[model samples]
Target: MHPDDLSAAAEVHRLAFVRQKQSEQWLASTLAAFPRFLCFVAEEAGQVLGFILWAQKSGFRDQAVLELDQLAVLPAAQGRGIGRRLIVQSLPLVREQLVRQGSSLKHVIVNTRADNHAQKLYRDTLGAQVEATIRDLYSADEVFMVARQVDEGARGR
Candidate 1:
């Protein structure tokens, strides 16, 4: 997303997370440095209803692991499969980037609030596995759950 889209994107982010205002400068800077970091929006009649931003990074211990940095859909648009569509579109981008970098991606990892209903959509609906649970990682009262998508060839193993 560009600096111009920050206002709209921030609005979506604010509605989704109920947190501090997202910085336009930060988004612009990050997008400039990493163009592959995607910000996808669901728009109808020229109005953006929701968005999902995601970035892929090599894991610290395993270079073959691709970590999803962020994913969120506006609260008003939730439960309509917009989030799932974003994730589904992102899988190929992740695979393409890995191939271009000559890396063999073995899995995709995402982190979400442990009690979040979205967790079931990602885990049960999308077939992601809970890889780990980090207590109080984001806040004193919140727990973080790491979910993983193993490559098709590694699914049964």
Candidate 2:
């Protein structure tokens, strides 16, 4: 996402994640991280509707493990497939960035409250599956999901 979109994106973050505070600072820091933390926003008619953040996990290597760090859409825009579009659209761009760094995406990891319905979205889009569950990790039980060998899956798309 461009620096100019920070405020609008942060608004979406605030609305999507009500429990989280300091939206501007959180978004600004992540945006500044660049290649290590790739951030993309979905906008229409100059209005930011949603965003997706992917972070390279651990040290960089030939095969990179990425975390689907954060996905947020304005509450009013929810259930309209903006979140799905964010994932389907930004992932290829992320793959291209990794390729330029002489790296390829190996797998993707996502963790969320067990009850969150977005698990289905991850499954459909990234082929992510729940690998583990940590009780009371945050506000509730958190499930760790992973999509293995994404290089092939990513290529097919």
Candidate 3:
């Protein structure tokens, strides 16, 4: 996603995640600061519909993991599998970047409200399994999930 889409992307988050509202300026600047962040937007005829942003962790090298930093789909765009498409489409790009760095994509991680039904979506779409839980991590319990895609390579650690 480019800086031009930040405002619309922020609007999507505000509408989709009614519980959280972040300034578009902050979101755009934060994304800019993360060179390794991979962001994608679902667009139609020049209008933004949704977006997903992921960033590498653990120093972005061997054994590094990816965190789904944020995802949002416009209220009108939900229930249409936009989120699923974002993940599916971003994987090959992520893999290409890792290969370019001579590194491997080690794991995929995401966090969400423990009671949220979207857990199923993350599990089914991303192969992520709840690996940890923290009470009152936010307004409710938060779950950290992982899809262990590079277990053999990760074993080096």
Best by TM-score: 2
- The runs of at least 3 residues in candidate 2 whose Cα sits more than 4 Å from the true structure, single-residue gaps closed, are 151-157
Off by over 4 Å in 1: 2-4, 23-26, 59-63, 140-157
* Selected candidate, larger TM-score, 1 vs 2: 2
lDDT (Cα, tens digit) per residue for candidate 3, span 10-83: 88877877776565865686678655787788998898999888888868677568888777788888888878
Which of 2 and 3 is the better model by TM-score?
A: 2
Q: How displaced is residue 110 in candidate 2, in Å? A: 0.4
- For 1-157, candidate 1 gives per-residue lDDT tens digits of 5566667766776677765455455456556655346555666576666655655554323346555555666677777776766666656665566667665555556677777776665664345667667777774333334444454432111
Against the correct fold, how does model 3 do in TM-score? 0.88
lDDT of 3 at 151: 35
Q: If candidate 2 were superposed on the true structure by all CA atoms, what would the RMSD be?
A: 1.8
What is residue 128's positional error in candidate 1, in angstroms? 2.0
User: What is the descending lDDT order?
Assistant: 2, 3, 1
Give candidate 1's error at residue 5 in angstroms: 3.1
What TM-score fits each model?
Answer: 0.73, 0.95, 0.88
